[model samples]
Target: VTITDDSEDDCQYEEVAADDEFSIQEGDEDLPKALQTIQEHAEDAQILASQSVLLSEKSVSEVPEAVDDFLCNFLVRLGMSRTLDCFQTEWYELIQRGVLSAKDTGLVPSVYTRNQELEMENMHLKKDLENYKLAANKAKEALLKMQKERDFHRMHHKRVVQEKSRLICDIKRLKTHYASYEPVLKHLTEKYQTTLRQKMLTNLERDRAVGQITGLQAALQNLESG
Candidate 1:
């Protein structure tokens, strides 16, 4: 009974492990989702930058140093700082504009910060996704291994059952043969006893006949003498 329970529990445990693996797979799927979100935002930023080229040129002069630093950092982080030649060239002119307010300059820095934050988040999520996928694969492999082992056990179980049945059938046949021969064996014993009794009786009769013949011969001799 304990063995039966253990076997059932092992099967259940394997199933649970497989389910855990699937859960990890689902978790990994979210990793790509976060990356996709970041990519979409990056694309949006690229589109905004392309459409607002003049805005970049105009803000370069009037934008605060903090905003300027933000743009520089953003470009550096994105590996595009060296390619900002036109933005750099127009910086002097925009500084001389003296028309746009500081508030108007804040937008670019905010966008850059937001992009950086999104990128970092996406990278973190990607790492998590990789871990999840690894776990899922490991669990799936274990499940497959368990299934193979279970199948082997099942086959062995079937063989054992078949062997047990065969043994039981053999035992029954032997028992039947033994039972069928019991009466015959008994009859043989009885016949042997009867034959021994008949032999003893015949020997006794022969001895008596010999003794009577001897006595008669002796009497005949006595008469001749007289």
Candidate 2:
């Protein structure tokens, strides 16, 4: 029994060695690719870590400007000497009395300053709105005046057109009235010419008749003498 067990154990050890050799050969082919991937990841981590530190330093440098310093700067910039003096007196008094602490005296948040800016902008916009309204009212009045003038001119033009129409009608009527008299004037001229010719013929016939009567009387006188 001991000899058979020893032989089985020897066969198992040889099979384990063969499996280990196969695994090593397969992993050796991909070792360089795995190392390159790990190297790229390490470089990316270093860049990210450096950028994070820069951003952290910048943010910290911007956050804690101390509320009192901000107020002093604001008052000085606005030229408020009396108000700044009063504020400093009160603020230092409170600080010496231990009524304020570092925790209570943080920087003024961006939200508050942004709100003040919005309020000032709103006031300016309201002023501009009022000015625009006044300008609009004046423009509306001017437009109304122009419209009134246009209406008056339109009415005047209509009256002038009516007057022209009436004048044209009167001219046409005068022409028709003159046309009625033209035929009567022509007939009167013909009658006057006929009367003048008859008068001339009657005068000639009377002269000839007078000459004949006188000759007959002379002829009778001659007969009596013979």
Candidate 3:
């Protein structure tokens, strides 16, 4: 059997032997059926080979078209002309430096190194986040302490104010009581002074009466002697 690749640039064919060429015993009753099976297998293999060739050709033809479409959509339509130019320059440089070869179909070492750097940066960010959380916790604790202190001071001030108000009310009540008693105190002082003056006048009048009585008795004695 001969298989040809018609779509290829250098079309070629490979010769494969058909299964009928296999030797069989002439007197065997299953020889025809066995030959028919072998022939069918050979036909199937040829069909498979032809289909594989067609698929290969199709894949090869579509590669450039796919690349073109990707470039148009990513660079031209998105207006990334500078990025496209830079990518082309980098590709050329990579080719010239032999960094990009047939065996290497992916990004170069720098891309991998950048990925490592990004991972390190992520780790640093995680550490910073933890530190920030710790600081926030401390700050929250301090805020709670301050609030308690404020509440204590506010209560202390309120108690002091209440005490001061009580003192003021007591002072005002004392003054009012003093004012109500002032008139009675003054009247008692005047009555005591009048009673003392009347007692002194009564003593002076009794002494005068005693002196007059003594003088009359002396006159009676002189008349009896004469």
Error of 1 at 115 (Å): 1.9
What is the per-residue lDDT of model 1 for residues 1-226, given as tens digits with 9 covering 90 to 100?
0011232342222223524323333346688766776676668768867867875455544433455556566577678855565565566467678554666444454455667679889989999999999999999999999999999999999999999999999999999999999999999999999999999999999999999999999999999999
Instruction: Please list the residue runs of candidate 3 whose C-alpha ends up more than 4 Å from where it truly belongs after superposition.
Output: 1-115, 213-226
lDDT of 3 by residue, 1-226 (tens): 1122433655467776653445454676796787896787778878988998998776564332222234434476458989888877876688789987654433234444456458668889999999999999999999999999999999999999999999999999999999999999999988888878887887788788778878877888888887
lDDT, residue 217, model 1? 100
Top lDDT: which candidate number? 2
Off by over 4 Å in 2: 1-106, 205-226
Whose TM-score is higher: candidate 1's or candidate 3's?
A: 1
lDDT of all predictions: 0.71, 0.76, 0.71
Q: Could you tell me the lDDT of residue 155 within candidate 2? A: 100
Top candidate on TM-score is: 1
For model 1, the stretches where C-alpha displacement exceeds 4 angstroms are 1-108, 224-226
TM-score to native of every candidate shown: 0.54, 0.50, 0.46
Model 2 CA lDDT for position 95: 90
